[model samples]
Target: MEQIFGGGIIWTIFIGFIAGLLARALKPGNDKLSFLWTIVLGVGGALLAWFVGSTLGWYKPGEPAGFIASVVGAIVLLAIYAAMRKKK
Candidate 1:
């Protein structure tokens, strides 16, 4: 954790929170999502963030790219969720 402690965890959490919120907002019938679902969106987005950062070189040896990548991933997921919902 110390490796990231220099500066990243907090931003990651914040981005996760925002990403979940955006996901919820973009989700069709998002009102039906429970609190647990929101947490999932945030955490899942955070996980995706790592991949995005590494793939795009946003993730330096020790940087705070997780937050932005997570947010972007969450937004993409939310858009997908919205599209799927639209099909229904």
Candidate 2:
């Protein structure tokens, strides 16, 4: 059981990293995020997508967001992050 839980975390991290990379590549801009930040962005994006999708009935409860949706969510987060950073 421990192994399963641990593996799930590792897998989530891997997916998050991939989603972040893809979002960065697809979105046009100079995003200077570190490796860890990228992963966080991806994971955050996934969560955002999940929330939005759930609210819109696009995703059922407990269902994970799709990769494309995750990437899109990451891009949205990146845009927002950039905007906030620009305000500083």
Candidate 3:
């Protein structure tokens, strides 16, 4: 079981969108993202979650999270993105 690429890329992106939307909605804050950015964030976050989940084996193929997990994962990805951008 791997959180990073559970199920595959297609599934990852599909679930990533759902996760990202929930993540943003649940933890909406400052900083506005265009449509593209949100998708990127979502997809990236899902990939990140997959990798991270793989480390802990928290995510399994064909099964990610209900909601909370996705939010947490996306939040982490967003935070990491912000931090990296801040550095650049």
Residues 1-88 of candidate 1 have per-residue lDDT tens digits of: 3232134566545555676887667655644556656656766776666656767886776554455556567667677777888899
Angstrom error of the Cα, residue 37, model 1: value is: 0.8
For candidate 3, write residues 1-88 as lDDT tens digits.
Answer: 2344356666666666777776677664664677667766776776565566756777665565444555677788777766787798
Leading candidate by lDDT: 2
Candidate that would win on TM-score: 2
**Stretch of 10 with least lDDT, candidate 3:** 1-10
lDDT of 1: 0.61
Alpha carbon deviation, residue 88, candidate 1 (Å): 3.1
The CA root-mean-square deviation of candidate 1, after full C-alpha superposition on the true structure, stands at 4.1
Report the C-alpha lDDT of model 2 over 1-88, residue by residue, as the tens digit: 1121123777878888999999999999999899999999888888888878889998876677877888999999999998999999
Per-prediction TM-score, please? 0.59, 0.89, 0.60
User: lDDT score, residue 11, model 2?
Assistant: 82
Best to worst by lDDT, what's the order? Answer: 2, 3, 1
lDDT of 3 at 32: 66
